[model samples]
Target: MQLQKKTRSGSFNILGISIKLSIVILIFFGVVFLLNKVDFPSPKKTIEKIIPNENFKIVK
Candidate 1:
């Protein structure tokens, strides 16, 4: 009876790990797909358009 319980616990642990790993992998691939679909411009262009001058700087 003790041995059976240990084996069941081990199987549950493996099943849990596999499920978590699959979820993480799915999310990673989804992010990659979304990034590829979107059009991202150069950093310089984005900065220039968003902040045209130095007046928007914050002083610490």
Candidate 2:
């Protein structure tokens, strides 16, 4: 009787863990889907800089 209880409890634990894992996966995908639907702004201004050769070091 004790052995039977142990096996049944182990199965229940596995089932619970799988359910929680699937829920987490679903929530992650839902967040990704919502983010895809939204539009984000892009940077419009362009800046240019020139670096002098004196700032660089030559390595062997």
Candidate 3:
């Protein structure tokens, strides 16, 4: 006669979530690192916005 021991599948659920979270955090940090090393061109034109005074309401 042979016997088999069944493992609990629920016990490793948290471990899986933690591993996924760490991988996401690692990828985010890697992207930030690469972005820091890059130099992007600045805008050639100046942005101008005209805000009408009527849009502002004075509150008592």
- Per lDDT, the best of the predicted structures is 3
Cα lDDT for residue 59, candidate 1: 79
Worst 10 residues of 2 by lDDT: 1-10
Q: Give the per-residue Cα lDDT of candidate 2 at 10.
A: 30
TM-score-better candidate, 1 vs 3? 3
TM-score of each: 0.48, 0.66, 0.49
Model 3: lDDT equals 0.92
The predicted structure with the larger lDDT, 1 or 2, is 2
Measured with C-alpha atoms, the lDDT of residue 6 in candidate 2 is: 45
Q: Candidate 3 residues 1-60, lDDT tens each?
A: 889777766456888899999999999999999999999999999999999999999999
lDDT scores of the candidates, listed in order: 0.79, 0.87, 0.92
Give the runs in model 3 whose Cα sits over 4 Å from its true position. Answer: 1-12, 43-60
Model 1: residues >4 Å from true position, as ranges? 1-12, 42-60
lDDT over C-alpha atoms for residue 9 of model 3: 61
RMSD (CA, angstroms), candidate 2: 4.7
Clash count per candidate: 0, 0, 0
